[model samples]
Target chain A: MNVLEIQGLTKKFGNFVAVDNMTLNVKEGEIFGFLGSNGAGKSTTINMISSLLQPSAGEIRILGKDSRKHSRHAKTNLGIVPQDLAIYDDMTAYENVAFFAGLYGLRGKLLKERTEEALEFVGLGDRAKSRPSTFSGGMKRRLNIACAIAHKPSLIIMDEPTVGIDPQSRNYILESVKKLNESGCTVIYTSHYMEEVEEICSRVAIVDHGKIIADGTKEQLKAIITDVKDLSIELKPGSAYSLQSIGKIPGVRAVNEKEGRLSIQSDAAVDNLNRILKSLMDGGAEVKALQEEEPNLETVFLTLTGRSLRDQ
Target chain B: MNVIQIAFKEMLLSFRNRRTLFFMLAFPLVLMLVLGTALANAFSTTAAMDTVRVLVQDQSSGAAQQGFAGFRAEMEKSGFAFTDFKPGMDGAAEVEKNNYDDYAVVTNSGIKLYGSDRNAVASNMTQGMLSAYADRYNAAAAIGAADPAKAATAFQPAPSGGYVKELSLDLDRMPGSMDYYAVALTVMIALWGAMSAANLVNSEIRQGTAARLVAAPVRKGEIFAGKVLGNLAVNMLCVLVVITFSKVVYHAYWGDNLPLVLLVLLSVVVLSTSLGLALSYLLKSSASGGLISLAVQLASFFGGAYFPLGVVEKNSLLGIAASLSPIRWANMALNNMIYLGDSTQVIQTIGLNAGLAALLLAASAYMMSKREGL
Candidate 1:
């Protein structure tokens, strides 16, 4: 079942549309990636979904409840970890988690247990008594997540949860996201860092100028650009090689040699790397090093948007 | 439940803030001490007074002469210099010209006292003494007509110290400087909670924490009410601390109607917090704190926080300014309740505060609802 469904969701600030006719569905148990650069309407869409911004038009449903008509029910099932730190600096980590959890209607021993569980889940159980003022940036981010997830909502929206943290904490947050998805909680993760989205997102959507320009799995998104792959091989100096034979290999579109190095372009769909190497060996070519330039999400993004994500 | 949780969180944050603590507790306490100590003579009825010069018109014949002499002797002891009335002397004109503090006419039937309004406090005291002397003389004559035995003793004169008693406080005791400022500073500082409420609301939006709150299941009204209640709790705690400190340390008299006094103070807190919330919503959050602070300062000044409202003449610019301030209303209500056992303004004060608070809260709620973004 889809945990969240937004149809024709539009939010306009006066004459300018911050989110224009956006439509999306986040199914249960999938980690959905929402990728966009600054001023790309990504935060605006996330805010509308989280009920922080009322849509100028359109509808949002969370866990089968209309977000506007049944806001409490919708919000009760949704968790939002904003990009900025929402935890209070003066409050202890435990108090911060407990306070937010209490707002979700958790109480008594259950509240205490859930608060502790959330702190432990975030890997800050030992520092539960410590205030956020003493926490590192990464720990604060973890605590921010803990505050959102303590109520065990059906869907969690994490907006740039790992923006400026150490690699270790980034990795920890990534692993935590995976763990949360594994436990049957759907997640909508937004980030400017394409690699983070590329690593964990089961399905991805690229938004630009208040609208989604592309939406699919990473592989599918990459497939939107082209199916060509470039392979380069460096040979030993003055090694014997049959350039014509290497070019004649099936799925090899073109081949060129420069300074004892052969650059080959081939269809990305074909698995001809081993055959190419075997043919090179048979041709008496001594391969010193081999390199392949495969397409990544960044390449797909750049090819589709005509600019780097960070540039915007 | 969410409202309460949010309120609790707000209270926690407020209590932890050092600046809020200073304004709420330390600032009021210190201000009360300084103002109360520095202005003690202003509120003191026991302070030494200048001798009041009275020109008496001795129009009575021999029958009232001895009685007049006894009255004159008693008035002389209590800082009064009696000047015998002379022929063709205009006592009223002389008193008006500041040559004498008062003029009196002693006749066979009674003595009429005319006092200058410039020195109203001293004039009122002298009038009370003359009235008491007349009552004694009449009683002595009444006794002489009824029976001759007690006439001489009654007409001779009562003890010297009994003439100038504190009759003005027959209903309740007067408040001293410490007591006055204890109420003044308490009301003023309680009104300062407007800034606290503004900061509480603005900080959430400015710090980006409000998005989380807006995302929660709670309604915007809950958040607003939670903040008001939380800030009110913190401010009331500070006020109580100031009150206790003044009452215990300086022996400031808060009177017997503490519950009513606190009720008046609670209204002040409510109004102040609501004002803060309303202003924060009506204006931009960035400028709301500064505006509210400025308003609180201005109100404190014109509301007689630094001095008694009596210092400002009625219907004058300062008096009109003081009347416009909620602080003045609250201060007047509390003062009346404390020193005069008057609950008349208590109802009006609470009504006005509560009414203003209701309006502000409503406006804030409307603004919150109309707000496009969190």
Candidate 2:
């Protein structure tokens, strides 16, 4: 069953639209990955879901209740870890957790036990008394996560939790997130890194221009460009070859060259490879190397959007 | 157990943070001590041998009229400005027209000086300078009548008449002492406490804890309430520190109304909390907001903070205008603490102070609640 659902969500700043007609759902206890480019409305949509921003025009239903009218109840079971580390610099990690616990109505022994559990989960029990500002970027990030989970929310939304941190912190965060998902807590994670999304997200949503362009399981999104695959060719230097003949080959679309590297596209990707390789050798094409890539999220991304997700 | 507990935590955070400590207690004390002491000394120093400005409309512009010339020179010698004007014009009118006081001279015989009775210091100084002039004139007449030659020497204008007022009071009661300044120092000290508390709210926004808090089931109002409690705790801590400091350092008499002073100080804390909360919201950068709020506090000093209103330029509008100052009221309440034997006066002062503090708190709260955390 869906624990959260958004319908026709829209947000705008002045005349510029930041999120438009965004809609998606999160299954109960599912690690939902929200994917988009830097300005693709992922955060904006998530903000609306987390009740941080009021949607310009849309409906957000959480636990089968209207979010705006029932925000008091909806927010009760929700916890958030923002992209920026928000721990108090003057407060010890334990104190930080303790403070947040107080807000969640946890007190006395209950608060202490929760704080300890969160600290242990984040692997910072020894350093719980240390100030977050004194900790390294990774340690601070971990503490940041610890504060959110200390509340023990049913729905935990993490927005770009691993930005600008050490690799170890990033790994720790990812592992912790997986652990969180394994429990009964519902997780909503947003990131632009395709590999990370492919690795952990049970479901993925690609959003752009304030709208969700596509959303499905990894296999479902990948199957869209199943017939199209990437082909790499490394030929001798200065060998510029225009294969009008290769373009006419069955199932072949076009051939392009870049720095003596040739990439070929075809509908019958696997079957057309043998015919293309044989023709290239027949034409005396000095092929130094040849490789084929099965269609993945990156190819599906290119096929769906007509632009690489990481375009500089 | 709820938001108030979080506020206590916030208050603790303020003390734990060194920057907040300086802003909460040390900052206001330093301001009151340095600025208060300097301004108070200025007042007492100026309050000493009164400076009076008298206008003289002398119709007889001849050597015979030169009789008043001795008076003018004597006035100048004694540190008064005895200004001369045309005979037809009124002396007091001329001074009043200049816009900071009242002055005039008498046209009648027997060398009478008609002084304008308007401001306190001016009124007191004018009467003294005129009497001295009259005495000298009488001596000159006596010498001129009996033995004109010797009388010239005897004509020392009545020795600057009656410079002292006839009053029965101890010398200790004069300028009200360091305790007078200390009461106000304590109340305003809460602003620093407020500043410390305000940072807790601001830190949440800065550290992203605010968003985390928002994501929880907690309402904004509860968060704000909790924050206020935190500041109040810090304020109380500083208040205790201040009371101890006063008792230990100055043996400061806050008044017989200890509870009243505390109540008024609480109101002051609330007001300052609202101000800091509002300020933290208006400015995206807490550092900048903190600075601007401190700058605005300069208004308190100008509003009769250092000493009594009469100490400044009693002749000027601003001097009299100081009577309406909130700091003046706060100080007056505490100053009146010295005379707590008179319950009526003490209650009145406390009531007025508490009322003003409430008004400030309301205004600050209304303004602060409008602030968006983002």
Candidate 3:
């Protein structure tokens, strides 16, 4: 069964459309990666799905319940870790989690048990009594996640949970996301880091200009751009070179030169590498190094959107 | 249950914020101490006038002279300097020549007091003393007519250090300086709760925590109600602490009607909280705190929190402004209850305050509902 489904979703702010005709589905227990450039409507869509924002058009179904008509039912099973640090700095970590947990209807021994378990889950059990203001950045991020998941919701939506943090904390969060999914919790993970998405997400969707441009498994997405390969050839400093004939190479898609480096894109790198090199050598270019690039998620995004994801 | 939890959490957060806690609790206490002492000194200085000089001219002979002599002795005992005018001297002319505060003309009918308007306090005190003396004498004469033995024992000229014979009408006692200021500062500081409420509401929104609560299963109404309840609890605690501290430390009288005083104070808390809530909805989070502070300061100034309303009431515009202040009504009602044992004004002010609070809350709720993407 699908844990979350959004169809024909749209959000508009004044005359500007933040999310346009967005639609997707997340199967239970799958780590669904939601990728987008900055201001690409990813947060807007997540906000709508989590009931923090009202969609201008269309519907959202959470665990087979219409979100608008049955918000409580939908919200009861959903947890959202917002992009911003939403934990209270004045409250102890335990108090913060317990407060949010209580809001989800937990009480008595169960409430205490869940609160402790959530703190333990985030590796903050020993520091539960410490306020977030005294915590390190990584610890605060962990506490933020603890507050959202203390109720043990069926689906957890994390928006850029690792945007700005140390490498260790980022890795810990990535591992935690994997563990959450393994424990039968469907996760919607949004991040600007394409590598993080590629590592943990079982399936991914790339949203740009408020529309999903690509959706599939990592390998499936890579396969779409697999026909193209980037060949980088570095020439000696001040070596003269021309691409008048190189552009005519069979299977070569595009050519760009910067400084003493020439980059060649071709449909068949292996088939066209030999000829392209010979043409470059014949053009009086002293080649210092030659390398062929393999296809990855970043390349896939670049191929589909004609721009680097990081640039946006 | 959710509202309680939310309120509890908000209260916890507020307590943990040391700066806000200091402003809420300690600031008012310190202001009460400083202002209460200063205003008390000013009032006592005014009340402690050495003597009021009066020029007395006897315009009647025979029995009236005896009456004037009796009245003159009583005035002398009560800290009045009397200068008897000779037959040809004009009493009013003598008062002006000697720069006396006032003069009196004793006739067969009654005594007439004349004084400048600048020294109204001294003038009023002199008038009251003369009236009390005349009333006592008239009562004594009536008793002498009815029973000679009783009049001789009960209605002799009052001894030098004793009060005059009792009059039929009771006099209203004015509140002392400390008592007046205690009530004024209490009302002023209680209204600061409105700013506290505004800060509490705006902080959550500014910090982005409000959006997190919104995403929870709780309804928006529950969230607003929880915040208001939490703010009210904290503010009421601060106000009670200030009130109790003033009563115990400064020996300020809150009046005999303890229950009624508490009820009216609670109404003030509600009004303040509602004002804060309404301001939170009307202004930006960053701007609301300063605006609330400014509003409370202005209200206190016009409401007679710092000085007597008489200082401003002489000006028509200021008088109207003072009358419109909630703090003015609260101060007057509390003063009446404490000094006069009157509850009529107390009940009216409470009703007005409660009604205004309800209106503000309604407006706040409507504004909250109308807000988009909150």
Of 2 and 3, the candidate ahead on TM-score is 3
Error of 2 at B227 (Å): 1.2
Q: Which model scores highest in DockQ? A: 3
Minimum summed lDDT over a 10-residue window in model 3 chain B is located at: B164-173
lDDT value for model 2 = 0.71
Order of the predicted models by lDDT, top scorer first: 1, 3, 2
User: lDDT tens digits, residues B16-116, model 2?
Assistant: 87876775567656665665456666535235555566665555444336766766776677667766665577555565665324454444364445544
- The chain B TM-scores of all candidates, as shown, are 0.71, 0.55, 0.68
- Weakest 10 consecutive residues of candidate 2 chain B by summed lDDT: B99-108
The per-model lDDT (C-alpha) reads 0.87, 0.71, 0.83
lDDT of 1 by residue, A162-225 (tens): 9899999999999999999999899999987888988999999888888989999888897786
Q: Give me the runs in candidate 1 sitting further than 4 Å from their true place.
A: A227-290, B47-172
Off by over 4 Å in 2: A12-16, A232-289, B27-177, B192-201, B279-291, B294-297, B304-309, B312-317, B320-325, B339-374
lDDT of 1 by residue, B141-202 (tens): 89988988878887876675656778664545778888888888989989998988888767
Per-residue lDDT over A1-312 for candidate 3, one digit per residue giving the tens place of the 0 to 100 score = 999998999999999999999889989989999888888899899989888789999889999989999999998899989888888888889999999889899999999999999999889999999999899888888988999888999999999899789999999899888888888899999887888988999999988889998898988888888668988899998776678688898887667787878877777545988788788778777889999877778778777876667667
